[model samples]
Target: MRLGYELKEAAKISWVAINSNRLRAALTTLGIVIGVATVSLMGSAIAGLTQTFEDSLSLLGTDVLFVQKFNWATGGGDWREMRNRRDITLRDAKRLERELSMAQAVSVEAQSNGLVSYEERSASSAAIVGANENTAMVRGFLLADGRYFSEADVDGLRPVCILGSSLAENLFPRFSPLGERIKIRGKKYEVIGVLEKLGGFLFGDVDNQVMVPITRFVSDFAYNPDVNISVKAVNTELLDDTRIEVRGIMRKIRRLGPGDKDDFAVNQQDMLMDAFMQTGGTIAAGGLLITGLSLLVGGIGIMNIMFVSVIERTKEIGLRKALGAKRRTILIQFLLEASFICLFGGLLGLGIAYPITLLMQQVFPATLAWPVVLTALLVSIFTGVISGYLPAFRASKLNPVDALRQD
Candidate 1:
């Protein structure tokens, strides 16, 4: 009951401090507000980016594993060395398919960036992927209209194509791309199908491209001396078996003997996620370092304000002490006042941060995870206790006779 009464008294004193030094309190808390706001906003943005990448990868199917000449979307290591590596060709893909009974399906792809044209409309710098019929199943591509290229078309090297949703919309705005003739690299090809909209990959939208037979691609553009082969496991449960089988097959195909390091890379969803996480950790560390400075300045400001409050309230402290107030009471009151200021500042910062985060989400469709919010709140409260300690101690140790003697 005495603690409750003391708390009420401390609350009343904190209210007095706030009401008396409104402008000074605002100025003092500004650093804290900015620090909290910055940390919260940056965390939310990073989380949103992480979620976007995860969503894009999830769409690509976690069961699929890519066999590539080099790491396709991760870790920058000796690109020149990777570039000099040999290509994985259609034959390699065929060999893998034939040897690996555990493999569900296999596809080979080559890509060129070029202009796609349909009469008056043309899309410049569009992605043109050369793939076989198995690409539809492996990449989870769905047909919006008409049909995907058949195995016969791929084998015959027929001049046929499927338009991604964006490419179709761009090249054939007035009518459907299916059954229409589109020119790619000066060669006219029939659009056999239009692919449904599959939103952005980590690189960008899969729907903003065109796909043709791997044979036709090789015949027209030829392999750039370096092409990647993508392999999908039949079932996720067989992932380990598939990996072992693929390693054996690729080793035989590449003619690498025992004790030789594999020249090629096997890329998977976890590899991409790990790469992104490492990058995100670096960015978050940098952000925290910058924001830590701001929080330090805020802490200093809190200490300064409390010191000033102690000096200014010397007469009040003397009178309270003369009237039977204890040193502990004095300590608790000043500390509570400082803590109140920090808590208020933190709440205010959150008010600003949350709305900004919501605005970003509305504008960019980004995800803001709850953990980020909770973390920011906790950090703010922690700042209050740590920053207020020294001044609270100073206030408690004041000599009542000396305080009363001061003007």
Candidate 2:
């Protein structure tokens, strides 16, 4: 009871001292306040960026794999290597679809650049994608109006099209695009579906393109024989097994000899995620390093202020030591004073940062999670300990006779 009482008395004295020099104490805490706010904001921004990337990539589907002539992330960053590999074609996509039992769905895809026109309005150099009926399922495309292409449309080589959300809006802002005939390179194609808005991807825009039947694309642009194949696993648990089965089926279809190496790449979402994480990590590390320097400066400032406070309170400390006060009491009082200052500053920082985080939600999702808040408080307490220890020790060890002799 006595120890507790002494500790409470010490805290009261420290609080009183802080109130006596309110402006000086507030100025002393400014460094800590700025440091905490900056670090918290940086952490939240990085998390927001990560969330945005994942949401954008969700259009690719987590369980789907892309079989192509080259890997987009790796492969020595050489185009010649990709070019020298055998071209993946629509036929390969068909063969894979027919032979692979592990795959729930497969689609053939190819791209070209063309101008889409609707009477007075036109978008030049628009992305043109060629796909079969399965493309809608494999690529996670949703329609805002009308329906996706049917099997009959693919078989008969119908000049049917689906406009991306932005494309539809640009071409037919005032009216619906369903059943409307649009021209692509002087060739007429009827808009059968207008895809729902998919925002954008870092790799490409998902809402500024058009999809047509594979046959229609082959007829219009025959120069590019390269086709990409997308395969979706039956379920999440079967992804690995499905990849293995796909590799075997693909190897047999390509007629590679027993000794020959595979020329194609089997890509899953993990590959893209891995690449993204590597880049994200470097950026996050750089940002944290800069912010860490700010924290170090703050810690230094706290240490400087605590030393000054000890010097100013030398006589009071001497008077207490001459009485019944122990060395531990003096140490605890100084430590509590420093801790209270930092804790107060940290809470103030959080208050200021809350509004900024809410505003950031407009650009990206910056949530002030409980874990981050708790961590900031814990970090404030730790900073107090590290910065206040030396000063607290010096005050505790002061000789009563020498301290009383000081002015």
Candidate 3:
């Protein structure tokens, strides 16, 4: 009964404190509001970006592996390590295709940035991918219209091209692009097909690009005879064997001794994810540090306001004490008021955060994790309790006579 009565009295005192200084209470909560909002926003954005990357990575297929001059996922390594390396040539890719019966398909790509023009419309520094027929299967490209280049086109070095969806839209927005001729570096090529819209990847929009035969690329635009290749295993079960076979083929082509280390890199989607996660970890840590500082400042604001409240209501405290209020009651009252301030601010922050997050999702379709939201709320509550301690202690420790005598 005593504890219930004390709690009731504490509630009454907290209500009075809150109502007595409406403007001050609002001001006190401002820091908390900003802090909570920032933390929530940052958390949501990071989670959304992570989800976006994961989705994009999933599109690449798990069983596929890329053999390239430089590692795509892991960034720059020792220059000396790559200095003596010879490029993986079309012959290397051919050998792998012919010898590796266990592998499903092997494809070679020679990429270059060039100007593509159709009539008066043109795009400069556009991605021009050079590959054979197997390129589509290895890279997961789907034809929205027409057909991919065939073995005849590749072997004959025919001046035929496939347009990415975005490129097609940009160049020939109102009509079908099939049978139209586009110029690449003053060379005329017929658009044989249009690729489906693939959004954007780490390498940007696959749709806003052009693809031509490997033979044409090599004959007309081969900057170097050796370029990297991409190979896909028959299935997940064959991935290891395929890798081993590819390594042996590459070593033999390069004439590297058995004891020589590999001069090339084989990268996969998981490797990309691992590299991204490491970078993301650093960014998240920095964001958390900034958020922590903001939260600390907000907590201090709450503490300062509670202290001022205690000073302003010293006589009220004395009056309650004289009427048989316990120290614990006074402490609980001030603490509850402080906590209420933070929690109120947190609710407001979340209210604002939800809509902003929704807007972000609309702008960039991304997944928002609920755990992040719950964490933000919990942190705000914890901040309130921690910040209120000093003020509540002061209120509890005040002498009744002294408090009453204070004007």
Best by lDDT: 2
lDDT of 3: 0.83
Decreasing TM-score order of the candidates: 3, 1, 2
- Which segments of model 1 are wrong by more than 4 Å? 72-79, 223-225, 362-365
For model 2, how does the per-residue alpha-carbon lDDT over 223-270 read when each residue is reduced to its tens digit? 556998999999879989999988998899899989977778788877
Query: How well does candidate 1 match the true structure in TM-score terms?
Result: 0.92
Candidate 2: residue 183 lDDT (0-100): 94
Q: Evaluate model 2: give its lDDT.
A: 0.86
For model 3, what is the alpha-carbon lDDT of residue 225? 59
Q: Kindly give the stretch of ten consecutive residues in candidate 3 with the minimal lDDT sum.
A: 71-80
RMSD of each: 2.3, 2.7, 2.3
Cα error of candidate 2 at position 169, Å: 3.1
Per-residue alpha-carbon lDDT of model 1 for 149-231, expressed as tens digits? 78899999999999989888888778777788989988899999999887754646478888989899988877542556667
Q: What's the candidate order when arranged by decreasing lDDT? A: 2, 3, 1
Provide TM-scores for the models: 0.92, 0.90, 0.93
Each model's backbone clash number: 0, 0, 0
